[model samples]
Target: MTDLLEQAVLTARNLPAERQDDLARMMLSYAGYDEPVIDLTPEEEADLIEAQAEMERGEFATDAEVEAVLSKFRP
Candidate 1:
């Protein structure tokens, strides 16, 4: 029961239901208290590392690539 967390809960209480849920999810994610595991094999890990290196080198898609994916699921 940290003072910061207690204050956050008190603040969230005044939010609308959707906003409250979004805030709760963000808080839990920040705290790393929610456990969702993604298991990857050694080769998959290597592939991911390579991909990340490429991204760091700016060898990646632009904002258009992301928006195209998101547009499909837009409500």
Candidate 2:
């Protein structure tokens, strides 16, 4: 393995089981494996459904609203 990947594996080894599993999924996907990487919780699924409903109803932020949020990060 590459030096960086060896180091990353060491770091990941120290993470919690859930976090390690998440990293493993990402690495497998990057290695060209076709598999589902994410398993969403019930609350997350509900949030996605609500977001879809909002989108279907044409509810969206205005351009000025977007700029207002972005301008906070400008130098």
Candidate 3:
């Protein structure tokens, strides 16, 4: 391993277990592993289905609407 990566692993080893797990998850995601699948609640599933129907019907937000929402986060 490169010196930088070795140093990072050594530092990670000293972190709390929860932090270590978070780091491991982040590294796995960065390495292109798909996140674990989660079962959605009934309400969430219904919402997703409705969203898909809206997308199929071209009822999604316009580009201007999207930019307007994003602008709220800009400095």
Candidate 4:
């Protein structure tokens, strides 16, 4: 490992367990590791199904609409 990475690991080793876990997750993400599977709740699953049905019916936002909605969040 590079000196900087070695130093980071050594520093992480001295951190609390939760901080170590957070650092490990950040490192995995930085290394392009796939995230852990997330099981959707029943309500979320229902929402996804409804969204799929809407998509099948061609009921979706247009690009302009999406851009307009996204622009609302920009500073």
Candidate 5:
């Protein structure tokens, strides 16, 4: 790997495992790998399907729900 990419991977090592997996997934997808970076559990798979259906049905979190979530990380 190039020095810049090596530095990025090293920096990502300090992140939480889930964030690291997300970065790895993006990298692999960009590299055109036709495979999953990680296997989702049955529940996760079902959740994704349900989320897609909700999106197709024009269902989304209300603004209050979004603000409530954002508030958790706000000072």
Candidate 6:
């Protein structure tokens, strides 16, 4: 098999039983076999809710702050 395929098989084999299905699904979706499924757990849902609340409360940086952050990566 190709190096990439061999690596994928090895990585999948190392995942926990619960995670192997997720990994397989992701690989299938990446290869265009199916739409990606997002069966989020409770913690993920809570994090999304908290992020939305923060946005609504204006808990964000200013334009200058954003630019300063992006400047670090600019060539």
Best candidate (score: TM-score)? 3
| Displacement of the residue 21 alpha carbon in candidate 3, Å | 29
Q: Model 1: how far is 35 from its true place, Å? A: 3.8
User: Across residues 34-64, which tens digit of lDDT does each residue of candidate 2 receive?
Assistant: 8655778999999999999999999999999
**Which tens-of-lDDT digit does each residue in 1-75 have in candidate 1?**
999989989998999999999998887777666875567999999999999999899897779998999999999
Evaluated against the true structure, the overall lDDT of model 3 is: 0.92
Model 4, runs deviating above 4 Å: 35-75
Show the colliding residue pairs in model 5. none
**Which TM-score value belongs to model 2?**
0.48
lDDT on C-alpha atoms for all candidate structures = 0.89, 0.93, 0.92, 0.93, 0.93, 0.89
Residue pair clashes in candidate 2: none
Q: lDDT by residue for model 6 over 1-75, one digit each (tens)? A: 899999988988988987999888777887768765677899999999999999999999899999999999999
Question: For all the candidates, what are their Cα RMSDs to the real structure?
Answer: 9.0, 13.7, 12.3, 12.2, 12.9, 14.5
For residues 1-75, write the lDDT of model 5, one tens digit per residue.
Answer: 999999999999999999999999889897769664677899999999999999999999999999999999999
Query: What digit string (tens of lDDT, one per residue) describes model 3 on residues 1-75?
Result: 999989999999999999999999888887668965567999999999999999999997889999999999999
True-structure RMSD for candidate 1: 9.0
Give the Cα error of residue 10 in candidate 6, in Å. Answer: 47
Taking the candidates one at a time, how many backbone clashes does each contain? 0, 0, 0, 0, 0, 0
TM-scores of the candidates are: 0.42, 0.48, 0.50, 0.47, 0.49, 0.41
Better of 4 and 6 by lDDT: 4
